[model samples]
Target: MINGPNFVKGFRVTKVKEFSLTKPKPRTIPVPQKIPTQKPHQPVPESTYRSPKEQEVLQGKKLTNRQKAEELLIEANMEQFKCANPEKSEKTKRVLSEIMREEDNKMAFNKVKVQHAPMKVDNVPVRLNAAAILRERALYQRQVEEELSRIEKLVDGARDPSEFLEWQRQMHARDLEKQLADIECRRLEGKLSREEALLARQNLIQENKKKALIKKEETEKLMRVYAEKRLQEEKEMRDLVEQVSEGHKNTKQARMKLQKYKQQIVQEVAEESRELLRQALEEAQEELRKKFELIREIRAMESVPFIRQTLVDLTQTAGHGLNCEMSIVELRERLALLKEAERKAEEEKRDQILEEKQLKQQHLLDTLEQISLHRAAQAKAAVLRLEEKKSKSQLGKAAIANNDRVTELQRKLEEKMTERKRQAEALKLNAQRSTSKSCKNSYEEKHWKELEESRERQAQLLQYGVVSGETANRMAAYQAARNGTSQAYVMPS
Candidate 1:
């Protein structure tokens, strides 16, 4: 049976081979050889190409099929070739079709079948066990709930979250919630990642806003402090200005007072200098007076000595006979005469002084008389005017009163008149005595006569042409004559 099976199996295999060989092979279409087509230098115009709407529908289509018939003909330069060789036109067309088919096949073969890498899930650090994930989610939920509660309390109280005393606790809770949300979202299918990122960004933006608010409040506080400080400084400056003004006023007053004091001191010094100068001048005048007095005393002493010596010389020169005796007597008489002459000279000087005193007294009397007359006239005028103003009754009483006062004034006037008359009489007597006394003394007269006699004798001697003896006798005779004449002229008293 095994052999029979083997023979059958072998017969089937041979029959399969005979059929495979005997069956006519299907005709295989020959693949065309590729000929490179020259690409156009310029892009085809939009009008000659498929519209965008059509291109979308015909995406991945052949450019030859999509191009206008005229564009294809122009690109291929088929018109010129057809015109030149009409017989080869169909063959060229077939060749071109075969070339285009070959190009299409090459493009199809070059096309990459890009299977996108299987969409990968990012490996998060979080464990993927459901129980652990759920437990962590619950914990994050509790934290979020706590953060929510704190934020709600802050909002209700109108307090800033950033300023909260427990702000760190809130921040930790928010971080936990954010991590949990990120992990959970990543684990979920079809979750929008953009939403998760946006939520985190929004939280960060809120934190930045809180920081900015704090900074703004601090800036406002600083500005307020600066303004108050500036106000205080300005006030101080104003006060200082006022103080300076007051000090300036005081300084001005003090300067004025100092100037006045300086002026007064200068005046005092000037006055003292003037007074000292006056005292020095007075002292100089007193010293000059003393020197003048001393000079007068010296002159008087000198005159006394000269006069005594002259008297002694005159006495010694005369001699002793009758003639000598006469000469002696004459000399004695001359000495007596000299004594009288000296007495007369003194009397004449005294008379001259008396005359001058009388003249001065007379002048004083005249001036007094004139003054009295003027006063009398004034009194008369006053009396007349007083009488005119008086009433009849008053006039009577006034007349009595005036009579008594007038009597008193008249008594005084009479007394003054009597004194004046007495003084005038005394002055007249003294003047008379002085003139008579001056005439009676005759010393100066005698001296002048002697000198004249001497001159006349000399002239006489000259006229006579006398010898010495004759001259002596003539002189003696002349002297005797002169003495006789002088004796005759002498006063009898």
Candidate 2:
């Protein structure tokens, strides 16, 4: 007479109670109590004793499973008071039986029957009513039929109860196929468009690559031509520099030679002037000695007296070959002649020295003029060398500018190639993304169909009961899985 909801709740409560009753108790190991020892002064009997193994165990030694079993058996026998005397054991068993029988009787006496409150119809008289019973059964049957039809409609998700779920499954499958076909078509179209674009891009890249190659070749050719020209110009400049260096060396040698020549000329002139002066000095000294000798002879002649004349005659008479000294006026005449000769010689020497000095001055003036001409030539060569160096520097600057332009062109070309490669990779990535999206869409459609089927199956299980609905579905799925069949998801009710 209980309602369905209440019955289910009571059934769950009963299951919980049964589960709790059937649960296993935790296992425990029973240790024996330590035996008391007697005093050392007292004598102990062997009959009231402990075994060695029991003593060891009491002292806290570990035992194996079999040893423990053996100990338990011994403990059980001792607790029962089993002894070697059969009569004593029989008497103990009889006493225990009597005590158990008395306890049973006491427990039976203690138990009392519990009384519950009576129901409303419990005191009414029973009457047989066939028609009423049949009508109640019919009502129950009608309700059962209605519930079955409602469950069928819910499971099928259709207006007509008679329609099989297979039709709906077929319709779902057709819709899935249509979606797959559409997706496949879109994927194929996208693939074709991507391929065509890739092909076009490849062609464009090829054309650009060809153009770049041609440009690079032209640049290389121009660089080669410029390098050869620069090399030729450098060779010309080296040759010009060598020639100028040789000319400078020659000019320096010429200047040094001229300077040596000028030094030699000056040295010869000075030596000749010194020799002429020395000769004139010696001539003057010889003239002075001749004048001194003449004056002395004149003084000796004047010093002779008249009285000394007699003595000179007497000496001449004695056979001496001495002649008479000349007179003073003759001596004076001779001295005057000597002085005149000396003066004439001096005048000749002076004329010669003056002519030599004029020759030396002319030689020095010529040397100075030659040195000035050489200096002018050297200054002109230096001006020409400076002009050539300026021209060479200008050429070097032009070559450097050309090299910079070529390097810039190469850098730009490399950047363009890298940009094209990046764009191609982006295109490939986009194509991959489209294909992945199509695949994901197909997988989602298949997953959605499976979800719908699982929901239908769960709707069918609703008729079993609401409380056990999920559990029954889970059990069915587990059984199906065990049997190697396809398992469906159980939708939550």
Candidate 3:
């Protein structure tokens, strides 16, 4: 390294660090990424505009600007299918599809485009990703690990194979031969011809001298450039600091002016409000004084005779006299009459109250009587229902018993018919033994007696439920009875 000259004050030489212009090898070890355990709390942003096609398809889905633009292009292309037959418009569809594909390609390129950070006054600062970066970093690390694992497995597998090992061994054997050749040359050193040694020294001296001169020139040029750049940066920083101080001063002045103006406005409003309140108070006091003065004037005029006296005097006594309080006798007479009228009014009021009380009592009695009557009617109705039920049951039993009696009577009548036949034969013999006139009279008399007995049996049978009681049939039977003969009715078989 070369030192600076002593003539320059405060300009000591510094050994600058050497920086290689070639790019550095990328790091192999991956940094561990932290996985998030919870969802992000921040809200996502949405686009303000959308295409009609997306509006129809998305329903409620939010879209980005790029997505909306893509949908709009697709919608325009699809409209051709509606206006023309798909078969006829195949060429048009193909052209639209081509246009759509190009737009999609452009959009895809923009989506993957690399974005560079804006440059600062000092330098372009590197941007740090939020939590999403950790996830991406983890994914990248996983891919790298997979590749490394694959390579390791391939190498490990190749090392075991006999053919692969033979190839590697061949390559290593060539390298070993070169190393042996180098060792032999080192062992054969320290012995050279006189002319050969002198020529090698001369060549070495010339090469070193040329390299040292070139290195010195290059170092000087690099140092000059570094010093100029540093000075320019220092000047810019100082200017920026001065500008910040000036801005602060201007802000302070503006704040003072704003505060002063606010105070003036507040004072003006307070003064105006106070002035309005004072004016209202003065008007109220003036109105109160005017009202008091009017009252005072009215009182002073009341003592005048004309103001006190009036033509339309409305004070009148119930007596014939014009004065009401002329003497005690007149007053006493009027008071007695008023007392009599008050007594009569009191009596009338008492009568009205007593009449109202009597009417209330009568209404209460009437309601109580009606309620009692209703309850009695309900009890009677319940008793009647029970009686009807008992009567129906009894009637049912009687009808059943009467039906059995009728069956027994029918059986007995059949037996009686046989006995009557034998009796009739005996009667016929007795009649034949008598004279012809006597026989005829006896037969007629005996027939009438049998008819009367049959009528009585029929009436009894009706009471026993063997026959029905009908008014019209009863009338015919009564007419037959009055004529002293039996009337036969043909019963349906």
Candidate 4:
């Protein structure tokens, strides 16, 4: 059986033979036997060609949807072409069909299957010449006029006019719908603009919040740094104080001495001891200077950037919104200087007033002293004159003289005595007049003073919120009435 299968397989293999004709001949392509010569140009018959538009449609790359519509119109024109010039339409139809087939093949590649469905041709918009287009338009308008005339005749004769009226109503509804659509469009546009504005505002608010948060963090950091620096300055001041008080820090004796000095400061005030008070004040001032010196040294050690940062911090924290013309510190210093100048001016004015008062007082004291001295000189002169008179009277009786000479001398002496008595009386009268005038003036001055005091008392009462004028008059009237009644009753009839 195996030999039988081998025999059959060998017979099949023997029968199978490769054909020589299936192999391609390895020979070069032969050149033309005769030299090709250019043929003479011959004019093509005009009957073989189509119109320019039909040629363009045939030569176009492919028919897009818009091209397809144009193609359909052009195809429909083929029939019009037959009716107008019947001789050429068959050849044009052949050209148009070939162009359409190529376009359909191209579209089939995009659509997954070839659709050989014939597109219904629309009427060709005959636009080759303006004159022809006008003729066609006039014909179409005439047809429309005839149709409208026929409708009007029917509407006039028929009882029912619902169809025409219904068309008019539909047109009005369309116009109304167009207006409503325009209004809705405007409303939507307004809404869109408002929404955009709201979104922009929200974005701005978020940005502001972010900026505020960052500013808050920066301020907190600056405050922390400032607090640390201030604490360091306070610590430095404390150290300086410790150094200044070191001398008094040693023993019981030194502490006692310092304590005693401080105690003496209080007693110094009671004793009016300016020297002790001044010494204590000078020591306090020295300590204060030491503190300020430490502060200055610390400040001087800081960099310019640190100082500028502190200045910026002060400006922002104080909400000064300072400009670059000057610093906040400069403004404060200027204000302080102005205040100090005003205070100095006020003090100078006060001092000037005090000096004037002191000068007046001194002048009054000098005048009083001069008056007393003048009075003392006058009294002394009077006493000396009296003593001289007494001495002369005692000596006159002891001296011897001739009777006539004595009488003449005595008469001259008596005349002199009369002159002295007359002079003394005149002085007495002058003194009395002066005293009386002074007394009269004193009385007038006292009366004026009392009047002024009464006026001042009334002013004070008014100033202290007392009811005046009408109330006072009423009270006075009531008192007057009571007093008059009492006096009348008490009087004897």
Q: If both were scored by lDDT, which would come out higher, candidate 1 or candidate 2?
A: 2
Clashes per candidate, residues 3 or more apart or on different chains: 1, 0, 0, 0
lDDT of 3 by residue, 114-224 (tens): 674432233445453333344444555576698798789888774445688779866665555455444433322311222234345555755876898899999999999
For all candidates in order, the CA lDDT equals 0.64, 0.67, 0.66, 0.65
Please give, for residues 150-242, the per-residue lDDT of candidate 1 as tens digits.
888887885675557478855665565555444433433112333344345655765886899899999999999999999999999999999
Which numbered prediction scores highest in TM-score against the true structure? Answer: 4
- Between candidates 1 and 3, the one scoring higher on lDDT is 3
TM-score of 4: 0.17
Error of 2 at 205 (Å): 5.2
Q: If both were scored by TM-score, which would come out higher, candidate 3 or candidate 4?
A: 4
Report how far off residue 85 is in candidate 3 (Å).
69
Off by over 4 Å in 1: 1-403, 441-493
The model with the greater lDDT, 2 or 3, is: 2
Clashing pairs in 3: none
Residue-level lDDT tens digits of model 2 in 433-465: 979998999987876666556556656667666
**Clash pairs, model 1 backbone:** 321-325
As for candidate 2, its clashing pairs are none
Q: Could you estimate the TM-score for every candidate?
A: 0.16, 0.15, 0.16, 0.17
